[model samples]
Target: MPAPNAAAVPVTADHGSATWRLIKAESKLCLRDKVAPLWGVGFPLIVLIILGAIPTLREPVEGGGGLTYFDFYVPVLILFNLAILATAALPITLAGYRESGVLRRLRTTPIGPARVLTAQLVASFAIALVAMILFLAVAGLGFGVDLPRNPFGFAVAWLLAAAALLSIGLLITALAPGRGPASAIGTVLFFPLMFFAGLWVPIPQMPPVLQTISYYTPLGAGMRAFQDAYQGNFPSILPLVILTAYAAGCSLIAVRWFRWE
Candidate 1:
């Protein structure tokens, strides 16, 4: 009888290692893409400058108990930047990769599709984290924004927001048919969702009907949670609950509907 073919045995460990290697490669490609860094970091900083320049936002509070508008707005700005970057970049890049057969080509390798997707998510989160830190630094040093009283609370809020937005982005990537359609849908979704986020206008100033509507939107709830952190107030637990539910629901939907092609 022929000698047992030891080499023929499937090496699951090798597959796991190869999957991670492919993930790293995909992350590098994403980082090298010029637009990702710009939108992720540049546009948000511009908004920070505009917020700092406003005379009303710069004025110090009389009672000294509350932060100025600039201080109030900085955390919201950071959250907004994270949401926009993750949602916009993930869908577009994933769709483009799928359309171009980059994801498909990986099927022939030891790397699995899920690993590739996870890599992209991780890469985006890493970039967003860096952008957020830089934004805080600039807001504090350049614009005189105050640090949050409860740093742990602030960190928790940021992580929750990232989880919620990243889930939505993944859902878009999995469900949207093609690059063009994904881009079109993302474009339509981003601005309207962001407007309710209180980035462009304060939520209190919005009409009663709109206020009620905004309460249900992810961006709005996220902004409220973030605002509470900035002002050193306790965040509403309800919004965090809502965010967790949304993330769970979106992730489930994405997994069920994801298309490799």
Candidate 2:
């Protein structure tokens, strides 16, 4: 039998163009999904309102001056919303693309498979940024939450948190090849992370053991870092450091195990 012809393999020199095309396509598709945008953005805002309405939340802090519970919880709420969207939506989108042969089909085209992944990342990040802006707007305008005193610190914290969450999402997509299972895994992670991270209840109110564990969880650390930024507190090096480490570890696992087909 004759050996297979290597010349039949597809290759393209204009990979950058292909990547841009994929990014645009992904953006359009994501925007057209009414339910996703509602769930990703609206649900979080609703949670913020409900949490902010709690009587204890509205009462002044005992010794931390007169900051309202709404003011104090706003940062945690924003980060929690962003984390949930990243964890839940990203994995499902990726796994669905893979399961539906979107990635496999792209391999036969001039576009590289990596472009599809990049497009998905860019689209997801865009949605995340919008959610962050909406959260900030609502808090600042509607609830009298002040802007971050250190804008630079706030930006750094946000970027690091996004990176950490994105890495975890990618890791989930790599490990769970099917869309249903990927969503299930994300659901398993979503609530606990949010609750322990102080999205539902104040960390100080939790039991000592739970508080200790929460401090070490990625979502908790991210929320703490965000809270520090919003309150104009000096950036806490530990949470950012832990987030960086988690991002690195998750990225490594994702890259090693990811499959296109």
Best by TM-score: 1
Q: TM-scores for all candidates?
A: 0.88, 0.85
The candidate scoring highest on lDDT is: 2
What lDDT tens digits, residue by residue, belong to model 2 across residues 164-207?
88778878877777789988999998888888788667888999
Clash pairs (backbone) in predicted model 2:
none
Once fitted onto the true fold, the runs of candidate 2 whose alpha carbons sit more than 4 angstroms away are 1-16, 52-56, 109-114
How much lDDT does candidate 2 score? Answer: 0.78
What residue runs in model 1 are displaced by over 4 Å at the alpha carbon? 1-3, 10-19, 54-56, 60-66, 107-113
Across 1-261, the per-residue lDDT of candidate 1 in tens digits comes to: 655997687787855676566667767887788556778778888888887988998887666466676776776688778777756778888888789887678667765545666777777787788888888889888987777776777788777778788778888888776788777777788887787887677788799988888877777778878777766777789778877887788877776777778
Q: Lowest summed-lDDT stretch of 10 residues in model 1?
A: 109-118
What does each candidate score in C-alpha RMSD?
A: 2.8, 4.6
